[model samples]
Target: MNLLKKRWLLLTAACVINLCAGSIYAWSVFAPPLAERLSLITGTAVTAGSLAAAFSLANGIAPIPMILGGWINDRFGPRAIIPAGGIVMGLGFYLAATAVTPLELILGYGLGFGLGLGLVYGSSVNTTLKFFPDHRGLAGGIATAVYGLSSVILPPVAHALIETEGIEAALLTLGGVFAIVIVAGGLLLEKCPDAFAKQFTAAAPGKQMAAEECDWRGMLRSTRFPPMVALMLCGAIPGMMIISHCWSLAKDVVGLDAAAASAMVSMLALANVFGRLLVGALSDKFGRLASLSGALILTILATVLLSLSDQNAHLLFSAGILAIGLSFGAFMGIYPGFTAEEFGAKNNSVNYGIMFSGFSVAGFAGPMAMNMLKEAGMSYQTICLLAGTLAILGLGFAYLFVRAKKAAYS
Candidate 1:
């Protein structure tokens, strides 16, 4: 009863942090205001706020905190880290509501808010993965998938809050939301008991060891780690292109109406959530290596089809969403399971952070490079084709990794 109670609490907290991260997927909602703030008026084809730039930067650069957060959790445990992360993150939102200038908003949302996110998100997968190692893939996927849904819900709610209550009130309201998530969930998030671990990981067992187990530098230098990180980077590389350009591509090439274009984005997120849960569960049954490799192959096909989707009705829409969602959710689904399987749970929190930077690298490059490439006369289709090529290459890497792992174990 006591351990179950603790898990309920911590899972609640993990869900909260995951939701905040997913809320980033709602960057489109803020683009208009941010654009206006940055002198990129809505009427202008390109907005000045560079919403994509700021969002990607904040999300990418922000992963730094995950390293520290994971380290803290490993040393002292989630009890100290999560609540502290929540308190700090809550304050960032309180300040964000008051932001007026572009620089101010960047600091508020980009740096400060980003920091809070980094702190909480750092531990989300690590903590939850420990709780349900049998379901690490599922557990981590569901935690991240909440953010997918967060994008769905927060945008409309945020709009309502901003319209009725005003931006300041909206900020304050969201701060409260973050506070609820942090406190309610934070209090809930505690270390899993050995019994819980036993029940969860009956088949794929875990070891109870010191909080500090792996050296990040040592992990970095190891041959085993880099391939996994590279696989993630390859899987994630084209995500920015799809999300940032989905609407424009739909309108410009596919000739979809505005309503259709909007629906497509929503469906994409919905598919992503589905992929996360389904893939994660399958990984638990099959193996992380198998599940992730299949996802990569699927992603490669979808990206290629999406690139040339000039007027395939919903095909472009369907393909693009599936690809983005798979790639987006795959990391969350795969990383925790992979790390736990390979490194032992004791070191998972810290080592995963170092590996997680592959995501940050994708975040930084995906948006800017996609846009820059398109502007430089590269067709979105052609670029997507290139992404497909990379995806195939990623699948090859995954194959090598799996083969090598088998050789080692056998």
Candidate 2:
């Protein structure tokens, strides 16, 4: 296929494959069922917070594969890693389907599936960024957007499947389907060819006008990297909490039914999808730091609103959900472009991989706090208040990053 056709095809296929990996976001739907099943088997009560820890643990384990996978992709390209990820992910889902204990669930769904997602997600997003150097934000956004979009599409389907076919069957069916789709998409993925790369590179000004290219080691040495990582860590906390525990919060705190809570997940996901696309495109125009600062501000606002709203105010609750989801999606959307612009694209897979460890930290911090707090009988309002504080901290780091970038460039 021609280079132009290949790029577009890669984007389309990557999006579809990410859709499969995105099922991780639908974990809220699975949590109740998995808990019930475990309860039946072990004759012990399973709390929602315990299951959320599994979700957080999955994200915590992700950085291992993300870094390793990105390093491999840098050397050998994405074809092998992508399909390998699919196989691992499929195995994980299958194992989770048969799991009867919390530890088993964590191993299967948390560690195994997270590893696969890290590999696949990093490869797909990085490849797309490489292909469109001039439009890095838009390209990365388009690629990552589908991952968030998957939350919108998969939850309802998973909920329906859980209701009808049962959770085990639902997991089995999804595992089988995702394995096929991801493998097929991997086969279609190709790095940008030399000719295409040169064409895109040529569009930018001479070296003086382009951003400096820094290797991972060099990037680490830079003053900007630390604050940037901190920003990502803090920025991720609120989103992680919402994605993993929002369903329970909605049902218990908002007084919503199971269906409404499920629908709320979809609603947040829809907002997430739009946020990715819109933030990415907007960053191209307004600049990444500015856009990110704006998003972080919104994140704080959302958390505060969510904390204030209660069971009686469903509309306000939904609005809070939308805002938080959008800010989360926007953060993901901006990251690839931000990383490339700040460090350089040549080592992006690994550089971003190193940076993505922030998500892992957030993963541990967010859910663990929620689970611990809930176990201690703390109100959900406290979680929101803490998240909002973290968002403020994130915004501060963002400002430092912006100043550092300016000092370097100027």
Tell me the TM-score of each prediction against the true structure: 0.88, 0.85
lDDT by residue (1-410, candidate 1, tens digit) is 66645655666668777786566655566657555534532244446455455565568666788888888887677777777777766776665556555556666676666776777776776888777655677776777667667878888877777679766677677777876677566666776554555554246322222222347775665556667887887777766557667777777768889998888877777777777877877777677777777788877778867866777656765776677777667666667667766766766777887777787778667777788888899887788888778778888788777675566446
Candidate 2 TM-score, C-alpha based: 0.85
lDDT of 1: 0.70
**Model 1, runs deviating above 4 Å:** 2-9, 34-54, 193-213, 406-410
Task: Report lDDT (CA) for all predictions.
Answer: 0.70, 0.83
Say which candidate scores most in lDDT.
Answer: 2
lDDT of 2 by residue, 231-329 (tens): 887878888887779899899878999999978977887888888898887777777777788888989888888888788888878888999888888
Candidate 2 residue runs with Cα over 4 Å from true position: 30-54, 98-105, 159-169, 201-210, 241-262, 307-315, 370-386
lDDT agreement of model 2 with the native: 0.83
